[model samples]
Target: MFSWIKRGLLVSTALLSIGLVTTGTDYREVYAEEPLRLSKSVYEKPNIYKVDESEYALFHAVLPSSTDKYIHRDVSSAEVYTNYLLQFAYDMSMLKFGETISKQIEKPFQDEILPKLSEVVAETTNQLTENEWKQVKLSSKPTNGSGEKIFHLYNEESGEDIFRFHVRRDQPPKKGHWFNFHYHTFLDGHEGHHNLGDVYWGKNMPPKWMA
Candidate 1:
């Protein structure tokens, strides 16, 4: 009887360890259970616009003057152009959500908001001219609670990524349920662009659209 009880305990312990290794360790299994369901509807129109040399110069002037060696040499020409697109999205999200939006809302935005945005931007690509940014693609499966979306804005012909945008969102607790958003742009091998700040929407956040 004693030997049988000891064996039973050992078996139970082995099964518990196996369950932890299989279920508790793999993130994919967890995500599968709560599978992200991104909607495919467009919430707002894509605001496609151009940034000429003068506009670019004005934008550049506002950035912090950096004497860093990487800043001087590695800034890509395409980055100068894509900055406008990033700015457009940032401005529009702020206008729609209000001015005090926080980072905490990023999960809801990803699960409930970004799918529609992905569709709108993809559709808008057809209308863009050769000189405009093209082939905008989501770079990876956005993770929940990450507060950001990663995108690769590719060049028209070369298929190379001209720039990538890391768009982050948050909503502070007890802050009227508002959401804040901002993005950092990386030009291929270069560090992120500077001086661009965040936008917010507090207390006046629009109702979430249900599909």
Candidate 2:
């Protein structure tokens, strides 16, 4: 009877060891292969927005390609591409203000706001690929009369709005009305305003935006 009991105990111990080995292999596969599968899904192409269809133009850059042997663009020889793009965005920002308001704040806008805005733009230049560059555009016809949005950097091909610059009339107690320039970005979920300094427009609520 004692010998039979001893044999039963040994069998139970061997079964436990086998179970532990099998469990360990399953966990290893979960840690290693499961994450690999998840990562591949996260980086998959044709990324779709979780928001409304209207927002499809704001974050469509799933994966931009820099290699140009794949697609043909007219500006292949362009060397000052980054600088030109910066200037292009800068020019579009001014156009949104129209001649009347632009003439008033030209110097301040160039001195106070431009440098900071340039820095922000420069930070994203590296992330931009040639594929995105070729399709980039500035949204036309900004809120022409007393509206908030100035313009946005949009990609026609990818349907991504990389950046949005805006200005609003502010009346602070007796401080009068001021054109508060600011911008928004696709990064950080496009939340909060990144101020670009203000231009005083007097108490009379400045002529309707581009008027």
Q: What would the TM-scores of all predictions be?
A: 0.26, 0.56
Q: Which stretches of candidate 2 lie over 4 Å from their true place?
A: 1-79
In model 1, how large is the Cα lDDT of residue 138? 31
Give the number of colliding residue pairs in candidate 1.
19
Q: Clashing pairs in model 2?
A: none
Name the best candidate (by lDDT): 2
* Candidate 1 lDDT, 1-211, residue by residue in tens: 0011111011112135334222221011000112112222322332222222242343233222221101110123332222233334433343333332324443455444444344333333434454433233333232233334344455434655544434444456766543333333332143544222333445655343110
Off by over 4 Å in 1: 1-152, 165-167, 188-195, 203-211
Tell me how far the alpha carbon of residue 158 in candidate 1 is from the true structure, in angstroms, after superposition.
4.9
TM-score for candidate 2: 0.56
**Deviation from native of the Cα of residue 71 in model 2, angstroms:** 14
lDDT of each: 0.33, 0.51
- Give the Cα error of residue 61 in candidate 1, in Å: 39
How many residue pairs clash per model?
Answer: 19, 0
